[model samples]
Target: MPAITAENQLALPRIERPGPESRPRPAWLVTTARTQLEGEGFQVRRPFPGLEVGIADPFLLLDHIGAVEYAPGEAKGAPWHPHRGFETVTYMIDGALEHHDSTGGGGYIADGATQWMTAGAGILHDEVPPAWLVQKGGLFHGVQLWVNLPASMKWSPPRYQDIGARAVTLLASFDGGALVRLIAGELGGHRGPGVTFTPITLAHVTLAPGTRLETPWRRDFNALVYALNGRGRAGEERRPFGEGQLVVFGNGDHLVVEADELQDARSPNLDVLVLGGRPIREPVVFHGPFVMNSREEIVQAIRDYHAGRMGHIPPTRMDFSHLVGEHIDQDRGGTRR
Candidate 1:
């Protein structure tokens, strides 16, 4: 569920309606997410860099974190980990996650806040729920997206963008049936606050039940619609989809999704994350936390990380010892000890 909402969406600026000539992007592929344990054993639904689609170009992985509730002392999170050659965008929708960046970018991204970290050359960090959430227990629902960087800028420098919920740009569809939370990129002449090395558009869209939403999309960028919750139909053909389903759209300047006339009690509306970037189109060699252009570059990244070149773990952060002796095949997407 989206943590931010407007009492009156009508009062918000409306996204201009796509003209009749605007080509509607048709749903090319639709796939469901696979549940898997990540980090320190928290369950996540990963939809891409996946079997259905090896990669989403410029975007690597999409992890849909829990809409699940946790009991006291049952909460878990990722311990100290290293990442390189990309950016990590974590958006907290309901609960909070405290981030400890070795680069002094630590903060609490709770209730619709975003932690955008650019692991340019490399960086080490840990993400965990706050002490209160861990000890008291409560609801936790969020998303962590991995955006790939072009080879030219992969080693630029480690940077962080702490986008508070208040900083998010809220927009309404042309007919006012949807609320679009612009996390990054531009839409209908409006721009979000996120800065990116790659050209992309990222927005959390909430479609009111029984309503239809159609908006103009950048023809240059790829289009993706990920159902975070609720039921919906996508494309001109009205292909039915539900929560955890990822819809990839084909070439067009317009995008569309229609919320079901009735939705589940828990999700009264269709909420989908709409994101797509200009394809990097370069060779991708992924191994563990490292994404590089070649297997040699991936190996170099691992060696650098082990040699303390990425960043140092702070004394206060907890170490889970998760990375030792794990060797993953760069192209096979498999891990071998």
Candidate 2:
């Protein structure tokens, strides 16, 4: 991956609403995330699979991985695992992670990179710290999202989109006081690089104090904002939010976000993730990494994994792009090629 240089910024046209839009006053839906030990002892804040289960339908879980510093050789990443019926999106803000999967696909996504893995049918994979990072330990921070696939598409062929930092669309703020990196869905009429089985809006936003953002969205999509750092106010009421807090919003045609404070040295910045998608409203039965609509399908997934139906990747280093279908070009700018 290349360094995310200033050259990656684009002065593209902003997304416009065709007509009058309703800006719903966002009422707070108190949601809490429970910390769990995941991937070889790393602490993760998980919102769903708990009281928040099925809150973000078509989106099963959101795992906010560490923003914690790790000493050399102290990082322990997830080993081999099997997933079926959904996609796993890993968005890295700091450090490096190497990934290998059962489909013979493998690669590494370092700082500012993202890996979108569609585990349709079934797939085995591993996400771990790269050898170099383990040798010279540094800060490791990122988020992983579990996106559920509709039952009809659960058995579709698996795929991947390894999006580099420079490849992500960075829509500058109207006044250049903030920026939004769209990972999936459309923002400001500019689409993200990720090709999705379901419609979704995922973005990483950085804001300077007093920066305000308003973007049109699908009225039916469920919206939420997770503060990665600093504090800010959002919506018509200007409800305040802080780091690590998740804010669920009422239905609306647009999202309103504003930054009100500077990030201190103890915090990173006013970085927040805006995620929303039309609810699938399907039966969700989860067993470990497998998410399916029925117990029968879950059984089949386990059998498929144990029977070696989902391919395998060797324990050593390898690149298996040959198994990936049509290539996705990495355009370095506001829109992906």
Candidate 3:
């Protein structure tokens, strides 16, 4: 196989959502489980609920948030947060999220949209529930990823991209199932959208029961899979994984996931998020959301954020003075003697 580079990568085509399969799980088998959070939100049982499964080499953190209801005027969503030395990806499965940043970038992402932001240097942003979405009160589902920036790009400029769902290409499917290739790199001979400073792959896949999906991955890159919904077996171990759980794989050249035919109708659709990247072998100094190589660098980031040197604040005229009170309480709660 040829090496995947920026110039030679193939764009994966867009695919439609597959129909439900016949062999649904037994009604008493408990197809979907529900987990609730007090201030954060709720998550429907899918791949790996809250546990961090999957490869730990290059990827740092992954959080699958919401597939649940968000009441109107709810201030329980993620408030203003800071990030540095890594890229954060927000892919929405349902509903939408309104995003605002200190860099004057603001937008609302609906279902199936993908937001890839590079916090190479430093960034402060907020992901809040939009007013229109609050009125609907439907399902608000999505996934957030933290991909470590390589040492070379750790101090690069901060950037953001909002990829519409229609723009994402679909790659060929195996065993009559389909896959959606999103940001970063490519899979199954299909390239993903969004330019990546470092070589990485992020894909959303849905497989029907009795189907098998095989992907060729770089041997040097670390890889892992998070099952969003349904049940399946992955890798050579054939470990049984349900929704809201992750399956971390050891070093390998490729990965194979097989959906069992025994899965019932309610459990016919198996959704997963795939991530892989080359590891950066360097010391990581993390303080809250800001990640840098040393404590001095982190202190510098804090200074910049306070000094108004990072970027201009958005001019939306929205009053955010109340957030200062919340930040003060958070600092007191997290402070060390």
Instruction: Tally clashing residue pairs in candidate 1.
Output: 0
Using Cα atoms with residue i matched to residue i, what is each candidate's TM-score against the true structure?
Answer: 0.94, 0.87, 0.80
Per-residue accuracy of model 2 over 144-177 as CA lDDT, tens digit each: 9888888899998989889989888777665555
> Which structure among the candidates has the greatest TM-score?
1
- Give the runs in model 2 whose Cα sits over 4 Å from its true position: 1-21, 51-53, 315-337
lDDT of 2 at 160: 88
lDDT score, candidate 1, position 195: 93
Q: Cα-based RMSD of the predictions, in order?
A: 2.6, 7.7, 8.2
Clashing residue pairs in all predictions, respectively, total: 0, 1, 27
In angstroms, give how far residue 274 of model 1 lies from its true place.
0.3
Against the true structure, candidate 1 reaches a TM-score of 0.94
Model 1, 110-226: lDDT tens per residue? 988999999999888878889899999999999999898999999988999999988999999988999999999998899999998999999999999988888888877888999
Q: Candidate 2 versus the native: TM-score?
A: 0.87
Q: Give a tens-digit lDDT track for model 3, residues 119-205.
A: 888776777777777665666777777777877888898899988776776564543454545555877566767788877888887
The positional error of residue 307 in candidate 2, measured at the CA in angstroms, is: 1.2
Which pairs of residues collide in model 2? Answer: 15-188
Cα misplacement distance, residue 238 of candidate 1 (Å):
0.5
